[model samples]
Target: DTAVSQTPKYLVTQMGNDKSIKCEQNLGHDTMYWYKQDSKKFLKIMFSYNNKELIINETVPNRFSPKSPDKAHLNLHINSLELGDSAVYFCASSLSGTQYFGPGTRLLVL
Candidate 1:
């Protein structure tokens, strides 16, 4: 059984489009995170949710939003997508600071 899963693993869209990604974890972890991997393979945390409260990374833009309705699910929404926003988005669940990542959702902005 998969510990973490993401829906619509691939997305292709035009610039200025809005998109959302869904994630769920069965590990019963209290903390979940969203990460972005750029073309250069630099991975950075965008947002984290602990017990349904959000903790966003300061460097992340307001256009990126993360919502966690419960401990087992976290979803990401991006408004006005740009070319630079094209990247692999990963969802992770952590217990005691050790994280397990889901298969990434690759978004391509044309």
Candidate 2:
């Protein structure tokens, strides 16, 4: 019984490498989102998909792309990872304003 799940709770990678984080939700929510929390613990919305359509895209780098195969899953792919990309990535879901987030995927770039 998983509400929201993401793979590799911790990821340590080298700069310029490409990696992908997978996410899935058991809740029947129509909207899903990806958020990034920096070292300061500032949570910011990166992307949001509603019914499989791109809804929100923040000032994230083009190297970061989000894919939503279905309402239950949204995966994030990063290319040419940088030290600044070393942060925690979170996947969330919601039908309205209230969203539920995953534990988070911590990426450490060296």
> What is the C-alpha lDDT profile of model 1 across 66-108, one tens digit per residue?
8888999999999999999999999999999899999999999
Tens digits of lDDT, candidate 2, 6-78? 9989999999999999999999999999999999999999999998899999998999999999889899999
lDDT of 2 at 34: 96
Each prediction's whole-model lDDT (CA): 0.93, 0.94
**Residue 64 of model 1: what lDDT?**
89
Off by over 4 Å in 1: none
Model 1 per-residue lDDT at 76: 95
Task: Report the alpha-carbon TM-score of model 1 versus the true structure.
Answer: 0.96
Highest lDDT scorer = 2
* lDDT, residue 35, candidate 2: 96
Clashing pairs in 1: none
The local lDDT score (0 to 100) that residue 74 gets in candidate 1 is 98
